[model samples]
Target chain A: MRLINQRLSPGAGAVLKTLPFVALVLAYLLGSALRLAENPNDKLLPALTTLADAIDRMAFTADPRSGAYLFWTDTLASLGRLAAGLGLATLIALLVGMAVGMLPVLRALLAPFIGFVSMVPPLALLPVLFIVMGLGETSKITLIVIGVAPIMVRDLAQKVLDLPREQIVKAETLSASTWLIGLRVVLPQVLPRLLTALRLQLGPAFLFLIAAEAISADSGLGYRIFLVRRYLSMDVIFPYVAWITLLAALADYGLDRLRRKLFPWSELEGAR
Target chain B: MTALSIENVWKEYGDQIVLENLTLEIAPRSFVALVGPSGCGKTTLLRMLLGQEQPTRGRILLDGTPLPPEPGPDRGVVYQRYSVFPHLTVLGNVMLGPELQANRLTGRSFGAARRALADQAREMIAAVGLAGAEAKYPAQLSGGMQQRLALAQALMMKPRVLLLDEPFGALDPGIRTEIHHLMKRLWNELPMTVVMVTHDLREAFTLGTRIVALDRTRSRPEELLRYGATVTKDIAIWPPRVAGRATLYDTEHPQAQDDLTAFASPAGTTRQTPSLI
Candidate 1:
């Protein structure tokens, strides 16, 4: 606890952060070596060359029938669903959250319903959604929305309510209309929080999106990985899982940068 | 010269009454400092004047006209915090008033009009002694600077009345004095109605043309909150001094054991609200 509390120099901090990543990679290599020594034909833990060949075929070569690169196509398909789902969630959260936060009537009416919806496991509704929406793009997108929207709405509504009450009164004195105060004062303030919320939800979103795709979709990273799972193709699965991690990390980093740029004061506030 | 009036106003939160039949009249160009103990509803009264809170049964009038149900550009306010938007730069925060007002009146705030508004905002920023720091966000500003930026933002709206709730409560003594000077100059130049709520009686004595304090007169602990608070002391200070007035208010303050229940002003009305006394 004492060591964690003490601040480290920039260089030392960087090195400490990279230490665990390096250890993980080294451990995986050693495990692969030990397994391969036991059985060279082990498909469970294929050699590095086997994984590289799979990547080249999936990434570089176009499918003979469809004339499309599987890796890129799968990435585009998956990212599209994630973006659309997140976009829909954000819109719903802003509208519903701000209303519930600002208006007592809205809060009394919808806040409980949103809370109830959030408590229900989103994955449980996937079957219902697929059945009703017919396993199309809408079903996949709706699954992501349902999985994240309720949580976002609840989080954002609480944030709005937590806003210093004086600011609301101050904005009122400035002649700001109800819509203007929400759009101008409240909207800009909550955006960084929303981004932070989005970054946190990356895990659950990926889970729901992948589950939907695995169960129904013809094309997606999850679809491809689950399709080859019958042969126990761990090589392709490993890289695909790693790709998801990389993508989520990149997204988190991107949002952090954008938040810092657009809402510098939020950083100060968070520190306080 | 009656710019604002609160006639038999009362406010309550469920079982607790905060303000009880409060009646007051503010002149068109007067600096009124409201002083009270903690939980005396001075801040509540300020909010009511700004039209942020409706009086439970009474009406508020501005220039003999009933105040609109909601707060508008007719009134401006500064709080202890949330006085400035953290997301905007000093210039942006000050400019928000003009941009919002312009957009409301003319339905457009683009091109050269915005540039002109920026120029005005820059002038207000400079007036508050924050010229070089216009581009800095609120977090980048010192406590005093942020308050000054807040003042600039509120003043830019050109409000008929300005309400401040402990605007300098968080500032150091030195900066607070500087702000006091700035406020004196602004009030000297403009004839806008200003009401400030403060816990410091000395501050109220020095800054206000008239000072009013709120407290319960009766000493029953059980009925303290039920009875709530009403205006106890209202005094007019003569011969307004712009600068070097610190010596005037620094003479003395109520000692710790003075018992505000027995407190009353030397001059002006020591009168209670209605028949409370």
Candidate 2:
């Protein structure tokens, strides 16, 4: 009976947790059906049909066995771009965040600049970025930095500031230098929070990356979406959007799992 | 030689005065406890002595040199809250000071100093009864364990003096007593100039070789209250025996007994006077 009760408890919790997602899916389906029923010739049905056809075309190749490899290659190219952009941003963000967080006067002086720059949308800066950096990978990567750096810097700064006074005081009494205190005591405390922040910024980074690629690049999934959109080919556009969403969700889940693995003491899951 | 001296120290917070013309001297290898009511400037004085804050009117000196502008390993301080670094393992926190100073002092790489500092940290942790917990993080430990880790970290540097501000005030009475005994043991094992501030009078009397009482005036208005009593190194000088006699007489007085009987039934007559000894 005890084992049965334990088994039933988790099932109930899972259902409760999934209720919101179920509601969202139901709402989307109902809204689409209503729109199609009202206007039989509406663009919505054609867009969905085009999306279905695109998936079918991608699923079956001239040689069915090679279709999987083609899909894999395309996926890898998009994933590789994301990984590079994210890796560069993480390195830059961690370094800048530590520097700004450690030095009080520097943080104060640069806070306004970070705030002002973060307010400017990434897409709005595309033209200026293109003029300055050109329409290469540099421009897109630069866009990702401009879009993500400020958020990371702000989150990391706040996290550092939020550290308990006692921890710093403990270090001070031990005659620890500023660098020692930062490297040993402060960085370890801040890293887990920064990782969580990076995960939160992942969605925005992808959005900015896609926007940059769509406007200026000749390759990338974003570029393909734009090409299909020009001819009103919803088939290609819908599939790409779904692919990006799925990838974003997977990446976010993986990062959250990593965060838990690293800092088991944190109560972030309860926070969510 | 005087290990620490505070001459005519005055501390003010903008307009409000926290300490006024306070003076103290601590001899080497002595344990002194500073007892006071809340807001009597015990913490402020400790901070001033540790060089965390500067006195407004006077000076604090260590071994005839004026206190430095900021805290250093020469004076180790343990706060009421266990201030162990939550991120680093027990050994990491303990070795941090020596490793940092070694690099600056000798221009040696951190790798060169790591093994020696780690050995020292391990020894200190074992001394503090945390021998097996050296690899554990602060959060993984209990409150008592965390405080012990803080003690180990502070003592690992082998500071000339140790300053503690209500180090056991946040713990439950049982844990507080245990920590107090541990502190006394550590003090006996390695004699260094020590100054501690505590609200618990029993703690002060139990652990202190010399007790400096603050805010005694409010407790007794008619008699000239000794604001501070520095218990001499000789234990015979403690006032507990005399104080205990007076308390017993007061409790046994006819009027006192009558009042107690009025407050309670005849069953309370068996109550005895509380002992501070």
Candidate 3:
């Protein structure tokens, strides 16, 4: 009990730091609940009520087989697209980021172009992308890439630029070649920052994915929500949204654990 | 033959000249210390020798050959700051040089190269008194330990010439003394040509077998001042005996040796025996 008290005392500042996030979440939940209570028969009200019912059903249900399989399948399909898009984005972004970061001329020439393109919203490009690539997986995947790659490139490049120059000079003194210095000295320092950036971008990546899907796709979570909204089938939309939130939370948590494991020095700092 | 020679080396930053017409020669297996006031171009000279910078005029030659544009395995340098890569473990930093140069492993086969390099790195680390720090990163170690790791990394390359630019300047006096002793012992065992720059007179006296002072003056030849003393057992002995030469003591006068010994002692030492040899 004494140890717990001491730990809590030190965490008082951290608790205060998180107070706003907690307050925002509480306000959101209370507002939605009050709105549902005031208009139980309204279109939006049934959707909100259906969301509550779905949460209750999923939380209390003993058997997963009782629920509709469409929700689960659509969830899996959405997750698969996300995985594919993010994986491709990560690979391409890393290559481009490393190249630009290491070479000054390349960075200067390409950075302006990338910055300008990143500002153009992916949704705004959807009509054009659909005209060119059609409403297929290619267009959707291309949208994901356009949305995620620029941020990845900028973040990773900045991290590379911020690497301690002394270390690079030391490597050069040791006669380390360009490739070896990049792989051994540069990459490890940037990995933690890259992982952190990737985790932070997860929420936006999912947002863009849903937006892309709603614009054109007839499958995945976004399409499911759109299809069900026509008949005011709030129960279906609620389950899908809830599942997406759960997936996002789970992914963020997994990345956090990975970062801690990979960087034990940061973990030590956290302990302090 | 001179193992290393610098002739009329000039370094300028815009309008300011750091080194003007500086010339020096270091013989094989000799320890030469360069000592002067701060910003006197001692580091500039070291950097030029290491091929990190090119002199505005003149050239640095290793074994009568002009130095290459880039630093090679022929010269190893240790900086005052702990320059070991913070992201790599101690072993990784030490092994990087050899792994990059000799092994040339590609792709997944780097694992085997890394292991072999790690073994040699462990030996070098132990030699430098960092026996169990192989797995630890640079940030986890103290400043002295990090400097030692840096030295180990340099030594593992086994370069013919070792260049240290005030390697112990940033360390505390006690740790500085320890590292100085360690460096002296290493030099004695390895017997490589070494050129070190330092501002600490005591450090120069302790580590240098021959010390040279640099005088940089505009429109004048750089003066090289050699201290003709040997410091041993914390006592400065007078008039470094010319190699393979004999010195006759003037026992009848005694004042000759007394005068010489008085000149060798550090400024604060009190002289009680004015006439005694």
Best by the lDDT measure:
1
Model 1 residue runs over 4 Å out of place are: A64-66, A269-272, B105-108, B240-277
Candidate 3 docking quality: incorrect, acceptable, medium or high: acceptable
On a 0 to 1 DockQ scale, where is model 1? 0.47
lDDT (tens digit, per residue) of candidate 3 on B1-277: 2389887777877656667766677777767888876667777788888887898888888999999987777788888774676656788778878877774443112677677777878988988888988888777887778888988998887888889988888888767766775776677667478888888888887777678887543323332221111111222224542222332321112211213343444445555657766
Best by DockQ: 1
lDDT of each: 0.83, 0.71, 0.72
Query: How does residue B170 of candidate 2 score in lDDT?
Result: 79
Worst 10 residues of 2 chain B by lDDT: B249-258
Q: Where is the poorest 10-residue window by lDDT in model 3 chain A?
A: A263-272
CA shift of B20, model 1, Å: 2.7
The model with the greatest TM-score is 1
**Residue B201 CA displacement from its true place in model 1, Å:** 1.8
- With candidate 1 superimposed using the best TM-score fit, by how many Å does residue A176's alpha carbon deviate from the native? 1.3
Range of the 10 consecutive residues with the lowest summed lDDT in candidate 3 chain B: B226-235
Quote the chain B TM-score of every prediction.
0.84, 0.75, 0.76
Ordered by TM-score, highest first, the candidates read 1, 2, 3
Candidate 1, clashing residue pairs? Answer: none
| Per-residue lDDT of model 2, residues B1-277, tens digit only | 2378878777777755566667677777767788766767778788887788898888988989999988888888888764766656788777776766666543223564677668878888887778888877777777777788888888877878889888888777666656765776677666467888888878877777677765523334443232322221223224432211232212322211213234333444666667899
Measured with C-alpha atoms, the lDDT of residue B272 in candidate 2 is 66
Q: Give the C-alpha lDDT of model 3.
A: 0.72
